[model samples]
Target chain A: MPKSVMHATRAGQPLQPVGRRRFLQVASVATASTALLISGCNKDDDTPSAATVDLGSGDVGVLNYAYALEQLEAAFYAQIIATPYTGISAEEQAYFTSIAKHEAIHRDFFKAAITAAAPGNIIGSLTPDFSSVTFTDRSSVLSTAKTFEDLGVAAYNGAGKLLKNTDYLLLAGKIVSVEARHAAVIRDLINNGDFAADDVVDASTGLDKAMSVDEVLMAAQAFIKEKITATNVGK
Target chain B: MNLFHLISQVEKLDPQAMDQLVSRRNIFTQLAGMSKKAALVAAPLLIGSAFNQVLAGNKDVPAVFNYALLLEYLEEDFYLQALAKPGLIPTGAPMNAIMQIKKHESAHVALLKGALGGAANPRPSSFNFGAAFDNYPTFLAFAQALEDTGVRAYKGKAGEIKEAGNPNDYLTVALQIHSVEARHAAHIRMMRRGAAGGGIMQAGWISNAEANGAPQVVYGPGNPATTFPSEGNTTQAGLNLVTALGTTYTAAEVSEAFDEALDEATVRSIAGPFIVA
Candidate 1:
């Protein structure tokens, strides 16, 4: 059994949204070949870099997987609201605010739960690279939002069965359905009536998408500033 | 989704059930070995694959499976009837989507039936789907209620399935169904939002509180809807969303954050009118 560990960012300023809420720290780094120094479990390298982050294993790993995604979601929505997209109505602003706040709470809730469950195992604040996402445009913002929201719904669906504890499964269930709601809303915003379009929900199966850890992490790597390994989750 | 019932049943009789693929012939052979009381006790254990897995679990696992089967029957029948009615559904995207939904429900019915073998509960004798909305306006509102109720109904029973534990391969499949149900619910909301009188557009997600004019949104005659109230409930696991989530969150966000769960009793009532005697 490997000891639960988060190698790089210990007391490293966790990612925080700019303005309004205080106490969050933003990091800088992007587009490098990955390094997962999850090894050297006992070794202490005084200097920390953005190269590698191992979410740990068992339930801790599952929690970290969720936390990483939440961090990404929180950052994504934060960027959207910070600079409102053009043609953004007052109604749109309020809706986006609601989305941002929910993601933040989701990010923080996992952080709090993991800290209580395993003090040092929680992953640090994730960096966001929204370079390609034009925050000034509603189409760009909504498209990005649609991707993140659908990815979240699929991630939870994939991860649920791996959970051993019923409490954790139930919690994941509670959150995932909400994610499904978010995905549906975003999809509708993009195209009037394609909320559960055949792309995400299979035509034959009548089932929504569920991605394996590798599949989810692969799709997620685009916006995320750091490399992640979800393959070992719950192993 | 209720794997516990199936797994424990398997633990007691695996190789026998395994050799058969929930084979009816083998299952019946074993059924003959037991006395009347024993057979009664073992009935739930006899499920070849997915069973009722309904909320308000019955120790008799078959009962749970039957409940789920009944739900599929209702959804499948309702959609099929709507698509069949003239001018009831708009001809384009709405019709196309409802057709897809009906197709899925039919698939669900087939899957559940195959899983149950000979034990599958037949669809209730006759079902009343309320006034067939000849127009998209009435239809979308009706669709929203049915889809919303379906999502809640599945969720309400999920815990029991979770508790049933492993080889509960049924749980995974059931969850697949549950998530899709949610998407179905969302799609309906999306269409309603675009409707002329649809005030729900600004509110695509199910809120912590039901919308002010939500009562009129429900479908199915005679089913006093208790499921919608909980849709807006803000407190979860004893934590009040408004107080605990900080001031930045407006009441709406808090409302949107968590979807409410329906218990079996409430779901049954919601489905009662639709399931004719």
Candidate 2:
């Protein structure tokens, strides 16, 4: 399980709610601070809240979800570029630079588009926690890159069905492929022939993995500081 | 509520629920036999394959799916033929990557045929690979083009598939397959650039329609310029990405950021020369 559950309940309550108080607390806090905890709270403990954001409903929610992912990816690549891991080849450095640019563009594109479409609904700039990653080690860096890239692909694949707008679906389609390409390259960097391994691509179906929104957020929760609620996303 | 959620619930109960139904070969009769709640719980799982069988119910989806199958067949055939040649691919890393890609293409072919069932298009008997088999670099170039085209083709069809079904989940399936093609394309590009001569130096992602030595037709605008723009397109959703953000990004970087789709007509025209059905 991810350190935190991205699905929301009421602030100061446990991950699951018990009664009308939970619903009432959630409603009262919806337009307030919206801060929930990122650290794993006990199943039944009444926890204090901090650093949380809610991905709103419908198309705006979907865009915010995408934006949240882009922010995570862009931050990752930017960090990779900022401190090149030991023994990183010149070629790998150059490739990382290009990838950083692509991710940054994706992040900024979502920001601009969302601001124009629904300024208030756009998600805030997320704070990434890359403490788990060892920037000094090439193996650690590339492996983390592989994880993020694969996660991005699966998230987009799963999210496609949730999109009500075809244009947004197409846009997601465009970016997911690029993320897949990144995933492939990163995998190859780790293991020359493991670009599309059986783990990532189903041996029986030949399709890449499609993770649900909750699943994606759970997987990504460890890398982020802020808690996120995607319950209303695509509803 | 989406029926897919129910399907997920049923899958949790029995992971092979759809497969068992598929083996029975009378999904509709079976669904009809079940109680309405059970059928409601099972319909989305059935829709994955039966939706194609229900071709008469929706022409648009089958047409788009068939086109996808055709492209998969083309790619599978292309990889199969190239892999068949003795020593066409290098022995170490190159061979390993090609073999992996070949397996994936074959898997994609199997998945598409399985999904489409009787409606699936038959594979072409012959292929005209010209100089692709003559040298390793040439093979890589052709492989890159086909993989890149596959990515774009699937992207182009997303709208078609999304519009056709009542949450058929084919759109998600197509998206799943779409990313795998991109992975293949990037690996092929890696192999090309790693070649000793540096003759086919290329980025893993498309950069300003740079075909390197691959077919130019794969990168240019398709039938209608508006719908299927060139791979070098810098503008997305009406804003030039390079200038959209306050930060400065080169046009090449902006273009490399997002891939563009090609219409089905243009994709068929590009792949038509090699397929001899």
Candidate 3:
């Protein structure tokens, strides 16, 4: 088995959400090009970029995957609280503070759990690239928060089947609902009645979006400096 | 919504329906051959799926899917009946949120019914909401409970379906619906904030048994306390999250950080009033 590793950071790529989504659409269509990256395991040597960090296989991979997302969320909320958006109301401020604390606690919980379970296998701290988010503005911050929360919920939901341990599965179940709550509140914050919007939750199925590791990583990779490889995640 | 009620109605229609389901208990036999851990984890899903197949006459549908369908039926009907009222929910965000939620519930009912195939025929639904629609605040309270319960019900079943060790992606689909329920719960909570006195207004996420513990059963434990803890539980996997995470978090924050699941029986009881024969 390959050791869990975090490679050197490669910076300087600012996030363009629209561009990334467009690229993902095109990449998804050109299946051959992205199949190797998304479908299965690609050894470190087989990959082009040595700067990638492997999330490792099975339960550890699942944990690291969650840790990475929590790190992203905690970082986003921390920034939101550090520099409150202009004209932030007292209620909104309270909302952000509570949300920030919850995200931070989640990140730390994942960190502690992984450290105890896998020792040195836990992934290192992630550096989130929030250049795309205009933290000074309420709409910008709330919109970004909504994206992160919804993504987190989908990521956890998608990862459920990957877990081999029932305990880990239950833990993930516990957290995902909270993430959903966060997603809903953030959606409402952005625009009332948008909590379970058709965009994230299917109108036909009435189910929230569920994204695979590859799909989640594709969207999340744009926000983090470190390249994450989950090819063997939950394998 | 209420499994007992639904089963009784089925029994009235066909005296040997339960016998047919029991005789074809493939999922139970599978459970018998598994280790304790696997059996414990998978029984809920396998049994549920088994029922789905037998009851729905759809081999592809899982019991958990039907369980979800039933809940969606209650919620869809709840909102549909409420919205149909003359001057019930006031205009603006409150009405708009209720409308959006109603739409999603109706969609969910359609999705589950589609999955159930021919067995998706409507069961008897004589709702007894009584004066809930006459007042907005009362309607919001019931909505919050139902939504919150819906979230927990889905969570309780998620692990079971995933651990069933099947190639089916039912777990993911269940989770997709689960979070949407949470979103609906939070939306309703926000709408009802400050509607209650004593500063016990509801938050987007649950904070303990909630104000006054009026509907304690909704926020309380299930058949087994160990498997399904209360909403205010600060402990996860036998570890006190508050103490483990240091003093930065209070019991409420710790509780809010994670939502607990409720077993099927508990959920049925909680939702019994709204569902009648």
Candidate 4:
């Protein structure tokens, strides 16, 4: 196996020789080019930096894009459960905890699957700041949960079609369904019995609204301190 | 070898050689039993090998379908379990509503199976509902898990239909099923909370303000935006009113929540096996 393939396997992603070869060459050139360009360019700007991982072109990019989002979520929930909120009610605590466990399992599972199939292109860790979150208050925690859950459903809805691989597409479907459940529970927690009202879903299209990668990443940037970019995504 | 060379070798080869080459190449001229193109692509790899094992023995189907079937079974069983329990449906109105939901889930199971078509595998005789319903805590946990799965499943498949380039008919129906599933999820969440009312908020936003008044909003009492903001009202109706009153949360807040939930790793883990198939 090539060094790139070995790196991918180590990262727990599937090894796609063709994709791997292309990714290595492209990534090396892109990184070198980006570094050189950055040295010459102005650093101050309000615009969010593009994702570092080039997701490649077409559906593969979409899958990798989706993968990056899942990584962020898994990390967030892992942290949430690792340190339970200060004054969590029993029911509320358990609910969030189970979600955390589920998210972690999902994260690991994707890591393994991607390592096995695509090989060597897993995006790096995302640093999240919970400084704004008052984990002690039930309202604060649940509200945060609601925000994450709702955004997840929309992100999946938006990117579902961009995937080229039928297998990856199927996997996305399964995960999105779970995200919807999280959204419902969190919504209800904020307001009693308000799980699927017109607030989260559209009455006219009857479809969950979608967010582009740019939109989703911008929103997430607040929580993450590191400058992140998507490479080979939808390339 | 180049693709053309491979194709030329197969064309010039004998019947047995052709068979070996085709199998080796993993290319199918026509999927034996599937009618739809997408199904043809998926069937040869998924149902062809795994279907027999699932049928011959009691093992679970491969990943995506396995999870999908499991969710369908859970939803089906949840309704049965809820209906079987007493005090879940109090009096005429609630009972009627519960019955409607039950019927819808039954239809959902049917449709889910329909998507599987002739390849529809047999249902497992029983499932471990886990510790979800042994008590309120367990029940809430299970309900959350199932609802979350359902929402993602629909969202995930919607794009598949579009990519197949078939009329959006199947996608439309799936979305419809998803909306109902969303309703089911909302209802279950209410039940988990032991709330008495119905028509809780759905998962997506409704942009139309004229037909439906401003969307309901919820706020933590700290903001000096409106009256009784400090009450921490947990009622569905109250939250809806508050959201409509003014936007307490930014688009970033809403979208970040979504990103956290729809993380690519999580979705891939759940659907990886099926997609690879």
Query: Which lDDT tens digits does candidate 3 get at residues A124-195?
Result: 987786756778887778877877898899899889888988889888988998998888888877777788
Retained true contacts (fraction), each candidate: 0.47, 0.86, 0.79, 0.09
Instruction: Name the runs in model 3 displaced over 4 angstroms.
Output: A1-51, B1-61, B119-121, B194-200, B211-214
Error of 1 at A70 (Å): 1.5
- What's the lDDT for all of these models? 0.66, 0.79, 0.76, 0.49
The C-alpha RMSD of each candidate to the native structure, in angstroms, is 10.3, 9.5, 9.2, 19.5
**Model 3 C-alpha lDDT per residue in residues B1-277, reported as the tens digit of each score:** 5655656655554343556545645567888999999999997787676655444532323566777777888898889899999788888777788888888898888876765555565744567777778677778878888898998898888666655433235667777788888889888888787453533455688886673423678898887988899998888766687888777788888888988999989998877777787
Model 2 regions more than 4 Å off: A1-48, B1-57
User: Per-residue alpha-carbon lDDT of model 2 for B173-272, expressed as tens digits?
Assistant: 8898899999899988988888887656677899999999889999999878877889999888888887778647988998888988999989999889
TM-score of chain A, every prediction, order shown = 0.78, 0.81, 0.80, 0.72
Per-residue accuracy of model 4 over A60-165 as CA lDDT, tens digit each: 5675566666767766676667677776677666667656654654554555555556676655555564544555566666666776776776776666545656
Worst 10 residues of 3 chain B by lDDT: B53-62
Identify the superior model by DockQ, candidate 2 or candidate 4: 2
Candidate 1 residue-wise lDDT, B1-277, digit = tens: 5666665565353332343234434556787898989988887677433343221122433455567778889888888878778877777877877887787788778876765666677778888877645566666666667677776666555556655543335556666777777777777776666565535554556765454333432322222333324555555444565676565566666667766556666667767887887
Error of 1 at B72 (Å): 2.2
Off by over 4 Å in 1: A1-49, A89-94, B1-65, B132-136, B197-202, B211-229
Instruction: List the candidates' TM-scores in order.
Output: 0.74, 0.81, 0.78, 0.47
Evaluated with DockQ, which candidate comes out highest?
A: 3
Could you give the candidate ranking by DockQ, starting with the highest? 3, 2, 1, 4
Q: What DockQ does model 1 achieve?
A: 0.37
What is candidate 4's lDDT per residue for B1-277, written digit by digit as tens? 2555544643442222343344434434445445687765786575345323222212222223344555566567776786777764455634554565566566556755654444455765654444444544345445544554455455454543554331223444554456456655545544534533433232232111111111122111222223112112211112332233244333322221221113223433433332212
TM-score of 2: 0.81
CA lDDT, candidate 1, residue A68: 93
